[model samples]
Target: MQITASTVSLTVDDVAASQRFFTTHLGYVEQAAAEGFASLARSDAALDVVLLARGTEVLPADQRDRHASGLILAFTATGIEAEEERLRAEGVEITMPLREEPWGERLFQVTDPNGVIVQFVEWVTPSAPANA
Candidate 1:
């Protein structure tokens, strides 16, 4: 079987607080939510995510190793610069300014309030070869 997509699960300290930050700041729509868990999706992409409850036995026994660099999600965008500008204007903390990579990708990054880093990229040229 071929793998389709991947999902990254995050254990947040406060579900409602994080939910609001995602919905209001990042523009993610609530797909599902409860006291213990929540799922949200960005209106512009197929990316979906779920947030798990923290501070329980279900949580990892070791909390000292928790980190922000643990995960990085990359997304494709149509207008990289404009989107970055908009996000910056809205107070989005840009970790890395937009730059074109040697592989022809214009990309930038931002971190959510909970410290989840997301990278957004737009291709500079068509990359599709022959087989589709």
Candidate 2:
């Protein structure tokens, strides 16, 4: 089947807080919103985001109170260093400092007001070993 688009739904304690964070810091635009729900999208190819407040009735009985945890919403990005710097200049707390792995993965992380972890990554050619 062809998937036309993608979205990630997150249940958070404060939907508005998460909403503001995504829109203000991540460039997402609000598509729709209600008392406890919000749909956000970006003009680019990035996946959409749906924020649902904890205990929202639309969720199943067992899942209503469950908040998003142990998840990191990662996006492949470019100019990661400048992005990190821009975020820093905007007063965003960088939870994970930018670092490059030996395999050529460069990444950093930030946590929104609702404690949602967002990460941006860039890839480049790995540096050759000094001995090689």
Candidate 3:
């Protein structure tokens, strides 16, 4: 099947809070919104996000009471250090400090108002293997 786009729908206690966090800090624009839902899009990327308020009718009755948890929404990025600095300058708290791994992944994270962990990662050349 050919996929035209990708979207992640999150059920949160406060849809507006997550919406604002994404738009204000992550360059997303509101595609649509209502009392209990919001759709966001970015012109530079295919990532689309939908926020549904807990207990909203849009969710199945059994799922309405559940909230999104234990999830990390990540973006593969370039110039991760610069982005981290920019976010810091904007007063966004960095929940995870910028760090690089041995296998060549650089990343950091920030928690949104509703506790969604937004992580940015950059892939780099790995260091020489210890046995190499």
Using TM-score, give the best candidate's number: 2
lDDT top scorer: 2
- Indicate whether candidate 1 or candidate 3 has the larger lDDT: 3
Which pairs clash (backbone N, Cα, C closer than 3 Å) in model 3? none
Error of 2 at 120 (Å): 0.3
Residue 1 displacement (Å), model 1:
6.2
- Give the Å shift of residue 96 in candidate 1: 1.0
Q: Which residue pairs collide, candidate 1?
A: none
Worst 10 residues of 2 by lDDT: 121-130
Candidate 3, lDDT over the whole model: 0.93
Model 3, backbone clash pairs (residues 3+ apart or across chains), number? 0
- Ten-residue region with minimum lDDT total, candidate 1: 60-69
lDDT of 2 by residue, 1-132 (tens): 999999999999999999999999999999999999999999999999999999988999999998898999999999999999999999999999999999999999999999999999999999898899
lDDT (Cα atoms) of all candidates against the true structure: 0.75, 0.96, 0.93
Candidate 3: stretches off by over 4 Å: 129-132
Q: Could you give the candidate ranking by TM-score, starting with the highest?
A: 2, 3, 1
